[model samples]
Target: MSEVPGPSKRFSTDNSSFSGAKKPRKTVLDSCTSDENDCSSEEAVYSQCNDGRMDGPFGEIPDHLLINTIETPSVSLLRSSAITPTVSEQSFILPSHIGVAGYSSISALPSFDDNNRQVAQNIDDQPSHEGATATWASTGSMKTLDFTKAQELLVPVPSDPLEAFLLFLNNDILDLIVRETNLNAERVLQQPGVTDKYRITNWKELTREECMTFLGLLLHTGTIRLNRLNDYWKTHWLFNIPSFRQYMSRNRFMLILRCLHFSSDPRDEDRLTEIRPIVDNFNTVMNNIYSPGKQLTLDESMVLWRGRLLFRQYIKNKRHKYGVKFYVLAEPEGIVLKFQIYGGAHEETSGQGHTQKIVLKLLEDNLDSGHSVYMDNFYNSYDLAVKLLDRQTYCTGTLRKNREGNPVDLSTVTLKKGEYKSVFLNNVHIGKWRDKRYVLYISTEHDNEMMEVTNKRGQVLLKPSAIVHYDNFMSGVDLQDQMLSYYPCERKTMRWYKKLFIHVLQMSVANAYYLYNKFSTKQRLNLYDFRLSILEKLLPKKTDQLKVLKVEHKLTKIENVKLREKKERRGIRTIKEIVRKECKGCKQIKKRVATLYECKGCDGSPGFCTQCFCNFHS
Candidate 1:
């Protein structure tokens, strides 16, 4: 048995490059010191080894290629064998791996020859099953799918990010929120054994404008992170955001956050009942506003939530491995086209495989338009490619070679780096290429051709066109996930649906920004600046010192003694300005009641509601 020299042994600049004995663990390519080489023999070795490789992707073939290839779909699939190495192959071994540096090993070539032979014949002769089976053609042209759908914006795209965002969160949605919020507050106050802070007199009905301001504060807090919500309204100038103190009182903000309800229905049977309003409304407006372009991508994304959830998923590869999972379909550049929540196994699929159902459902409206979808191996299959073609959609992605309907001999034919094997029948093309490792792909579009691409190091390289196109279009969901992750509005909460609701709001913000860029002709704004613009627009009419926190106003012993002696001159009076605050009188007895009037001749200008004031002053 001949030894296969590891990577380092085959490319050593030192001519006595037979250092295989010295470096026991290193590969043939590792021993080479330089990133480049002028080795002529190595070039000949690559050319000789990579002969008759497939050109692009799926190509022309007869209909019989995909027949069960066996008796049952559930039957044990064939495992392609290690191609018996030829005499010349055994002799001409270069352990060094090819990289983007343009085949740098400068070494003498060992003698070998299989130039006149066809690898397709070898692939065909090797039987994967007992019966005669299909095999790769080794050489063929591909038919890459062109993205033909140029979408028109369904509505006039707004130039302002805030207006674009408002298209989804319009007056109707805001009004519903206001009504429910107010109703829920009243209901909470009426509950048995309710605390004094939540009493009917202490609760003020929330207005639509106030709701917008509340959301603005939430969005702003997402960007300027702090340890606690109270920190934003702190009295100290060093840490306080004056706008927070002036626009909304701290207790009021907490009140809104606590009682922020989307639906009035108190049913626990439907887990999604609480947040269904926002999710349903946002999903509708998202697709109605803008149409996506030719290329699309489908994948799952996770929202970072480690708390208790009925349907939370743990995906080891995801950035937020433990969270609620969402199946997302989006354009290649990060615009969310459609999304569905994974509510559990019951809601996962209708009647098909999980992959097929998700892809079909997400593309339900976008299909039959000649658009191409790029996916990873998890969702790629020969069955899926064929199913998509039936709907006039082209599917391109890496496939699991062992998946049912794959060619019998593909595994049998081993490929070195830069080499590929492919067989086609009609529109479906299945192929495996060797790069850093083995890669299997199935595609309905994309012809067999090499594409010139540049690496980050600015080096030019040639890759299969299918591989290049897949790399270009497959990160849509990931990109959307990345943008949403930038300024997440979600916070710690006991309700999983609330966190989910906040996450959907964050998605709307992202979609709004994408729309702003897509339509507005003027100076484009980044996400942070765009969100800032929206926040400013959504802020309620400002007031002069609504809830000023006087942290240093703690009384000394003398002041504390005087605080008990309320003079007759101090009186309950209505101030010209209408502001909501915790009543000073209510606070005296450890209660929290909102007041609309202020007390005259008071040291701190504390507020007092009608009933609470007369009770305190009397």
Candidate 2:
């Protein structure tokens, strides 16, 4: 400079605005301003501007021109035209300057008006960056979220008491009971005397209401119909459900029918015809109501009924007077399966004959045959046993003392009463009437083989061919022991009552078997104990009177009894005819007229009095 400046400050006539700048200008020699270098500088500035890199001190150009340059020119051109902007340079540029600079004579920047708003609307219509990124991330990710765990967190936990109660019920137990009972929701809902208090609308919640409903259904299906459920409830050691009391009120007839049916004969056509449809319907209903895979035992029972009804003309076998018979086929667990009423003439047939007919009919009908038929000595006949064998059924019962032939000798044998021994027979005839011929056979061997057989009246009969044992006479200290077990007792007191007692005792044995199977355990029970247990629970308290009222009304009209008179013949009288007199009129020939005149119109008397007709008309 003319007045030499310090080294840090420099100026030139063309660069006077560069005074006080941080950098000092060089002399002509030091600057070395060649044409090639000048060309290079111009090219750098043009490239930078065209590349849209103008910023900070170099970014003073108007926004319109700047925008136009950016729109039209390539980034390389901008970078080559001028120096590339640094981070600091780019940061300082005003947003307004983005399109105003006319470096490329660019169009004006968009204003915040309708056209710009529409453009913005178009931009808004495009998919968002965040949304696109999310979609990409979801598709590209390797690990996935576990939904079950998530659902557990999202769903609300049950807070209601009823809902909590239901969670406690064992699903398996419920399913088991439902399948066994075979009950439908509607049937359960409509059970007699089922109060709304115990009605369950929601099964998921095991509330008191649900318990009541379950109990109601159970009672409806089980012994409730048989009149034994009350006994079971009262006697069973476990649960004491009070709700069953309400069911007893309306189902007495049904209960009675169940009991009668259970203990009656299955072969009596009259009873079978009357109840078959009902039993079939019950089975169908039970199937529909219950789940499959539940099983029940099939067994037989018998009851005896005798009265005026047995002698009615409409009743079959009305001719008989002494004995009445009822046949009952039941489930192994004592559920009634079928029943028949037999009396009068049918009783005259051998008990074996009756039993065989019934069993055969049931087999032919495909009713049920899962268990051995149990019977007393009367039903145990060789012919019947053979028939059962033919039908593929087992028979477990006592044998009649007087069978059909000469008894086997067992004098030296010390076998127990009701115990078996083998004996060979060369000629053993079988079957009813004369249909059977001689056959070889092996029969039971017992000490009473040659003893005289008798009926209840003690009438001795011809010795039977086989010496079969009566189950009643078998002795045991533990009466509940198995039938085959050894025991000791005097056989002298064999009577009908003893036999009957034996039958009752067998019921206890059967029940014990049932209980053992049911609970998968070994526990014995006797009839007396069983009956006592049942009575204790079943007997109503003195204070609890039966709700039904009994009324007896007599007919108002009195009827006279009429008796028929017997006809009698009198001996002829010959002496009374000696006093006959004759009457003559107008000298006509006349015969003597008797004091009595007989009229032709009437059988033996005249219309007038006998004296007047005889004396005046004659």
Candidate 3:
């Protein structure tokens, strides 16, 4: 068996180059300094024996020449083996003892031909250790290798830093600048000095108060420019600029207008105050606009006002002492068709009558035909109703009771109440004290209209069997309750005045809420809830002073710091104690001691001197 050269016996570069022709010289002796190991020398001698043989005379050469020539072929074999797969020749046989050893057996194991051949062919295929060994054993001479453990080292490709920085600037810096500047332009146009023509320019141009006022108006009008506001904030330079905080103030006049247009409740005081002056001016406006062929409901609203002298002098009726009354005429929807405010001293009878006459005269002078008038029973007398009828306008109201001196038709009286039964008269006279004959008509036929009128004792008095009858039109308690509930007031004393006011204010609030609901398309909120929500958002705080705080450094130095300190020190106190002796001159009074001073005896005589008193007295 031939021995293979170990790693220690490897040739050096300088010696291998100097070896002669025909056969290479062994350079191992020069490559390694001799160590005190016999196994290494033995191994080298064995390696020299297996080195390639030369033919004839060359083969018979001296040991030194043989060694040199033999080393070349062995080195060449090892070099080729490292780069490519090893091939075994028949002469290179393994020794029996060495082949039996565990180390030799492992080295002699079957090489991986199938699995590792695929791995070697494809650069991406990674082979396992067992696979590589099996592959080598199967293909050629067995050689132990761990190609699976090998790692492919990589080098990162370089990038241009300047180009990367420019990209970042384009996306993060330049783009941001463009957005901010555009918003700033918008803000500038909102400024006070900016013309309405240029109002779209920029956000920074507007003052904070101006911006907020515009926002408030838009909100009140239910015109939210959400997208526009967002765009301005995104781009405007002064988007986050601070300003002095102020509480939002409500426009009372606008609120009043809202009420007048929408509220069904007539008793809101605030709405009443707003409507009062407008009511006084109503008649004047109507006179200007009157060409009336239009239908109008003429009615009066009682208003309450406070004044000491007026109340005392004009309130001969005890009820009038608290408040004055006003008359208002309007459409059925309470539009203030016309109105008048009478003085407190005005009489309900003559004063109201005179006012009606004046109103009628004004209508006659300015208005054309086809107009109809509506009034309550109080305004409906035989004389006035007939007079209005003569003016080519129809009048409708309850008639006064005790309408007498008219001839009766017994047969027609049998007809049921609320049942239409009309009679045409050849000549009808509506005299001041006499009943007039006319056609009677009823609109609804309900059974309740046929009820008997009776006294509290269950005795039937007058059964309502006639189609037309004269009876007192009692003011309905249910109507009063409906009126009061709809137009809530503090008390019945202010019922009329309060109802009028409340109706107006509620109308306005309702209108505003309606507008908001219409725009929002949100069904969750009702009119009342919507108004409250808006009120909360708009008027977050009640007072400006309460909301103000000294947050700025300069402002803190001037005001808040000292005030805070003083408030902290107000409750502390200090005390001091002094030691003193008790007086000895005052006490030594005996038992009862009834006559200690004797002032009574001393009062009558100058001789009984009172100059000295007991110590007890002192």
Pick by TM-score: which candidate is best? 1
Error of 3 at 377 (Å): 1.6
Score residue 216 of candidate 3 by CA lDDT: 35
Q: How close is candidate 2 to the true structure, as a TM-score?
A: 0.24
For all candidates, what are the clash counts? 24, 44, 51
Better of 2 and 3 by TM-score: 3
Candidate 1 residues 1-618, lDDT tens each? Answer: 123333443333464433223322212232222224221332222221212222211222122321111222211223222221123322224334622122221111111225522122122223333121333455655555555667667888686888888988899899988988888888788778876655344678899888888988989888888878889998543585777876788989888887888898876655667887887788688777777788889889998888777878899999999998888888888888788887775563733467778888889988888888888887876667767887889888898755545666676788889888777754677777888999888788876677889999998877778899999999988888888877866777636876787888888889888878877887899999999889888775464444333223321111111113333567654434334567876786799886556654445657777776566544
> Cα lDDT of model 2 overall?
0.31
Give Cα-based local distance difference scores for all models: 0.67, 0.31, 0.32
* TM per candidate: 0.66, 0.24, 0.29
For candidate 2, lDDT tens digit of each residue in 193-309?
767575233222223333334333332332233334344344122433433443343243222222121112246634333233333443332222222111211223322223334
Better of 2 and 3 by lDDT: 3
Model 3: lDDT of residue 445? 13
Model 1 C-alpha lDDT versus the unseen true structure: 0.67
Off by over 4 Å in 1: 1-148, 197-201, 264-270, 348-352, 540-618
